[model samples]
Target: MKFIISVDCEGPACVVGNAGKALSASRDYNFACREATLEANAAARALFDSGAREVWIWDSHGQGLNLCIDQLDKRCKLILGKGFTCRFPGLDNSFSGVVMIGYHAMEGTKNAILAHTYSSESYKNIRVNGQTVGEIALDGAVAGEFDVPVIFVSSDDKGCREALTFMPWLETVVTKQGMGRNCALSKHPHMVQEEIYSGVLKAVNCIHQTKPLKFKSPVQLEIDFKAVSQAVKALVYRRRGWRLVGPRTITKKIESMREWIC
Candidate 1:
């Protein structure tokens, strides 16, 4: 089976703060980056062993280039930088399943390491049909459009909990438990890797049992901006006839939201 992995850094093993420091060239970021690489590599190894013949991975982190390309498994390919959305850049739904590795809880998640919705600076919370969402959920929806199920994911405990609201049957591996964005209880990188390798196998065995996420027609999306000024000045503002539901929140239907997002 073919699977796609969308990897992020904030929720990886040993990741307790924003991935910014994790990707920096400084000594501090050096260790964090190493941890991020190990987590992705481990997850990639698991995907390959679990009957996944072809695994496509997207470095879905800051600058989209945090992964140490040399460390990744030779069998997998990576996607990095802009113009990427099946609806956004262009990853079509042609895989059996998708995996979100190293994701975190949405913005405002207390004790969720480096929790931030979308831009952290732009969004307070994002929801679909009134349910809270994070990157894992949004990307899963993108996969869903093509009937692909997100079978496995790894993140912090809060992220794990938030994920179930979207896919009750999906398997999740929590690599950390946060006390705040900057502090957390991290799992050993090696231990996290072991689980990553195992989770993929388990997911493959039960892939057929779970259904792809299904959203109703006329999908609705609500965005709560972190700043009211951004909501007012955004190019998308008034571009799609979105309604002002709250001071910093905008509610718009798919067609309208599409115009704004796409």
Candidate 2:
């Protein structure tokens, strides 16, 4: 079977504070990048050993250049960079399932390590049909539009719980439990890698038991910006069904998941 492994970097196991550190040019950021690459390699190896013929690893974190290409498993293709048409690039119905690694919780999730939606500097919260969502949910919805299920996710405890809310049958490996936005009780990097390897194997093995998650047609999106200026900037797309809901919020309606993203 074929699969897409999307990697992010804000989970407890990867960083201790300011999720953005994973993208910075600092010592801590460098360590987080290495750790993320190691975890991805572990998952990719497990998938190849478990009979996955094609595996694409998408670096979905900030700047999308976090994974170490030279060190990644040679068996899988890597999608790296930004300004793509979709968050999960090269994704389509052809893939069997998706695996999200190193993800965190939604914006405003109390005690969630480095919680935020798309951008902490831009968005305060994002909701679909009135339910709050994070990057995991947004990516999952996009995958669902192509009829691909999210089989596994590795993140902090809060992120795993958030994913389970929409995908109850998904396999999740918690790398840490958050004490707050910047603090968490994290598992050792080696231990987390082990869990990820097993998690991917179990998820691929039980792929048939899960289903893709899709929202109803005419999807409504409520985006609350962190600042009024950000909300005003988004108003430039007002003709695209955007309506000012509050000083810092805008609501829009779209026909499909593709539209919701665009």
For model 1, residues 62-167, the per-residue Cα lDDT tens digits are: 6676778898888988788765433324455668888888888888888888888767668887888777777777777767777888898889999998888889
User: Which candidate has the top score in TM-score?
Assistant: 2
- lDDT for 243 (candidate 1): 77
Model number with the top lDDT = 2
Candidate 2 segments whose C-alpha is farther than 4 A from its true place: 12-14, 18-27, 237-239
Q: Tens digit of lDDT per residue, candidate 2, span 168-203?
A: 999999999889877788899999999999988988
lDDT, each prediction: 0.75, 0.84
lDDT of 1 at 60: 69
